[model samples]
Target chain A: MKIDTEKLLMIPGPTMVPAEVLNAMALPIIGHRTGEFGELLVDTTEKMKKVFQTKNDTFIITGSGTAAMDMAILNVIDKGDKVLNIVNGNFGDRFAKITLAYKGESIKLENEWGDMAEPEAVKEILDKHDDIKAVTIVHNETSTGARNPIKDIGEIVKDYDALYIVDTVSSLGGDYVDVDKFNIDICVTGSQKCLAAPPGLSAITVSEKAWEVIEKTEKKSLYLDLEEYKKKYNEKKQTPYTPAVSLIYALNVALDLVLEEGLENRFKRHEKLAKATTAGLEAMGIELFAKERARSVTVTSAYLPKGVKDKEFRGLLSKKYNVVIAGGQAHLTGKIFRIGHMGTAKEIHILATLGAIEMALKELGVKVENGVEVAEEILMG
Target chain B: MKIDTEKLLMIPGPTMVPAEVLNAMALPIIGHRTGEFGELLVDTTEKMKKVFQTKNDTFIITGSGTAAMDMAILNVIDKGDKVLNIVNGNFGDRFAKITLAYKGESIKLENEWGDMAEPEAVKEILDKHDDIKAVTIVHNETSTGARNPIKDIGEIVKDYDALYIVDTVSSLGGDYVDVDKFNIDICVTGSQKCLAAPPGLSAITVSEKAWEVIEKTEKKSLYLDLEEYKKKYNEKKQTPYTPAVSLIYALNVALDLVLEEGLENRFKRHEKLAKATTAGLEAMGIELFAKERARSVTVTSAYLPKGVKDKEFRGLLSKKYNVVIAGGQAHLTGKIFRIGHMGTAKEIHILATLGAIEMALKELGVKVENGVEVAEEILMG
Candidate 1:
């Protein structure tokens, strides 16, 4: 299992793909136009809708979660259409950029990098921009380990005449997104993040409200044409072009596993693991990352001892101790490492990742007051 | 495996994934930031370049072939830039649209849908458009079952300054594409066609000249940014965003198998099998969809008998024989049915597919000879 002298991935997605899912993908190839492929497509779609917690239209495309984020804009925003994007982390900025790709006239309702969007910021944007065609935000920001106030923001957007797009890339399976209660027009997620499969596709649940707006879009699109794909998908389970069939097979199995676990239990397990890990990190004197309000249970970003950059220290963990942790991206690079507790990760896995970090920190000669002692206290004793 | 009562895929892409490739993908997950993930990334890219027939910098992304095709344009094309494109099938039309998606202008020089791109037609376009920034062509048009005169076209392009971009999504591993000698600036391909991995990633090799042009591209991008990816990828084998890791693992194994068979042997096997299949179809009075000038060896498009429409015939094949073939796409819908000879396909598979078609045609009461007799005579003789 150690690929080329490397350790296992205990982090969130690309989570370890199960043998059954991979075995399912290994089944003989079927023509995408054939009945067998169509049934597989239909089965996967039906199961995905259940996971989305919606009776609405659900579909998939052969791309990463980022592609789903991109499509949310392609389907809803017109060229030069004003979009109100709430930025909390890298993903939120990307949502805004996707709107920009299609020439969307957009405004980023700013916040401290790790701060979740407040109802007041969204209300202020909606009140000011009468021309705004859509309100976009991330349901969970994995970069800084923050979950936004999506339900609260959803209530604020309901009064406005604009589409609401939410990126649930890292949170959909680990937590309940409640797309209906959140009034989300487009809720997107990827299988690799929390569904425990290989990465290749993005599943997006679209509302009738969003579909109506997309029908009138003037963008010269062929691939990301939501209405076109929807029409063809309805006639048959076939996609407009060749789809990732094996990924779909893997998706079907992964969704079954998720449902078997039950959404409430899944969310609770993630919460417990996150709380336990955070408590351990704190006891070791490592502080949790900034989040003005809400945060996700899937991951926690923590600052290393002052002046002990994550770049050198993290490399040592992977190279010496066989553990992997994400360095702070962009401005936060070299400042912290992110611990993921999503998908199939367990309490033991969390502790193992932490222990490696403690070992790496100790070798780096950083200020530490018996780090493993506190971590073991919460995780074991 | 009869999913949703739909037939299995036997057409060009989304081919049956081999168990070894799937098992390779099922390896335990590794953290994306750790050296383990980075090492895999590096090794995967190295093997991918070999599959692409180029030593130029290659990159992997989580998307279908279209995604890679579009990325080729995004990095190299600017708004209003003119591109000379040769359209022979459904995929060629997609390339044209992809160019337009980035607001780049396309000067299309096309043959009939089921015909090859004549070398003279390409030369004529090259001579006419001095402003053409690049010349794009599909190596194999799956819908048409035709291969363009790439070698001849390559000689022609080398005479001009236009960057030659090739879409070898179906042809790369099954057939030989000499990127260096063919003067290809950007060569793009997907995993499922002949590589025999699951459908999830699209890879591309970029020559230095193409990189220079990409450097000049000022179009705003994030996820699909080629320059940024190349920089980070060279320094450390990591993508800007989380990669399709499982698909990459599958691709690595698929590439190994492709190389094990040896590229020359693979090409020759495809050529021999293609001839036998075509001879069988012809003996049964089924006309070839591809022209005589350049027929692809990986897929065969057969004109259905007088009374048969695509959907009805394919359905009967699935229900009765468990055989699958693709229907015509775009304006050619119902005109021809395509049988893919790529991926884990060998002589026996092709023989069975052809035999099933004959049975299906007979079931539909078409006037024809015995399919098995004709096929057996061609292959065993």
Candidate 2:
């Protein structure tokens, strides 16, 4: 069957953007130093704080989520500083890599890819290393569809001297992240995930405690320097460098959509979507990848049916049904597939994606049935 | 008179983007890992090579131009490495700052803001600093509207053992940048400038010699690391991190527009536009800021007429005429104003901008005459 050329993006990030947000991005470009852009920057930063559930000073960086994650670490962890990294999935491991790259001593608390970081393990590590300057964890591990217990880790770290840093790149709007309430010192998120905006822009909220460390740390990066950003924002309500102006416009509108839907409502919708996706996949005889308690609310990971090739299945789904999904990364490649239902994804997208997966599996000689029906049951309920 | 709320950006960067390029950016977001996006990435990179007029390996980065500049310096200069930075304007000084931030000793070859870097001075400095690992210069200083003689400096630097790094952030697409011919080991440019694409993405070209230096340099930045980007691109035609997907789409189209117009034709157009802008300003009794030999072909810097206030004049232009221009940066603030005539700017924009400036100057009681007519004569001729 021939499908429309526009393929639905069900990958973890660069999620489907809304027309309103896209239109906002399509608006005429504006100078970053202008008062008009300053107003936009201030408005977007304020709205972003609400989504983060924090009153901490937030900065919009013109790079990927990793840039924000890098900034979060590089600003606080000076050379030879000890940092505790909780690694459960790909992005979690990335923090450790970034820490090591900057010559910081990284002590990682490890977990299986499909499992969440244990709060007890993080506490034990922190207890062992009194010199640890920060504890870093990924709120949602998009690679394995696992959601870590960031709040629990935050609680344990707050009592210690180590600053609490969390990468909420794929989970900020889709999941509840009470940064201030959880005593998070630094929280980072990207625009392309649950914000339903274009990629390339990331935001980080910094508490006063983080600033204390940042101010004392030696300058390591000119572009990712948070002190310069804070100074510029304080003086003119602008970024130190020219920002991704169009993406800023898009993010402003995306924030409007998120606030209009309400944070709780958005989280509920993501939960419902995750439930539908998992239910549909399980009903189709596909095994869920992540542990039940660690399942992510934005993306769902499941094993391919026996005898179904990963590339063939995904290609067939994309070419024949115009549905796009993600394959596993690193060691899990070709063993699992991930479906993202975050941001602008709706009940219809879930049904269509499930139907596409079932069709592909059946065509590949795997016994599968009632996937869309099961998804509909959960979504409608 | 009341004017439309839509602003016409005449800033040196975040230049005006065409509607077509903006519409391309509005397209549905695609997963970066998809074959479709890979194809787009390859196409854009290939076309970018053409615009750069080089056969060197180029990578698209997900941050502003400063990120690329930072990447260029940090990737090559290790701690205590000596780098010669030719400072003629703000961006030139920025290169020195990035070097100093990374703990590299910066030797400055200082030129006045409105003057070009002297080739003999660069050679003399290189002769003195035989241990210098690199020499950095800005091809076009956006802050001062001065175009340095990159080819001349490139010729001098090629004889030295040091790598030649050039920041062409505001010049690449609108000016002639023969990276290979100029022997630039590393060149950086931003998307929002002459590319006429939305701000946020920057591209860097690394020569084989530059890669050798980069490979041996200690890791300082994880996000701006060039090695990871090269590895990812060589393994699969993709960025190491998730790219600004929408901006990439927009850039693909912008490159198409650029190539369609032809490089020589585009350069000619830009030169003509620059001529018209300067003529218009001069006719309005404004003094050009940059020296004759150093005048940039992308942005024009001019001193405000007697009794003309920078903020008040720009405010009148923006509020009454819906035209926007930039004020001087750093120490030059409130003393001069800059007019950008790059990217999608044409004769009509130049005329309109000139007329608005004339009206503003007249409102401030400065005598001005035939500015628009003079600009039209240059453009139409």
Please tell me which predicted candidate would have the highest TM-score against the true structure: 2
Cα deviation in Å at residue B372, candidate 1? 4.5
Alpha-carbon RMSD, each predicted model: 3.0, 2.0
Q: What does candidate 1's lDDT look like per residue over A1-381, in tens digits?
A: 237424646565666666787667655555666656788888888888878888879888887787777778877776789999888788888887777877888799877776677889789879987988998898778878888888888998888889988899999889878888889989989988788877778888899898889888865445566776798799987887668777787888889988999999899888877777777777778888856356678888888788786678877877787766677767878776787788877777777877887778878887655555565555553
Candidate 2, residue B352: lDDT = 86
**lDDT agreement of model 2 with the native:** 0.91
Candidate 2: regions farther than 4 A off: A1-5, B1-5
State the lDDT of candidate 2 residue by residue for A1-381, as single tens digits: 011338888989889999989888778887888888888899999999999999999999999999999999989888899998888888989999999999999888889999998888887887887889998999999999999988888889999999999999999999989999999999999999999999989999999999998989998999999999999999999999989988888899999999999999999999999999999899888899999999999999998777778999999999998999999998989999999989978999999899888888888899986888888888998
Q: Is the docking of candidate 1 incorrect, acceptable, medium or high quality?
A: acceptable
The candidates score, on chain A by TM-score, as follows 0.95, 0.98
Top model number, lDDT: 2
> Model 1 chain A, poorest ten-residue lDDT window?
A1-10
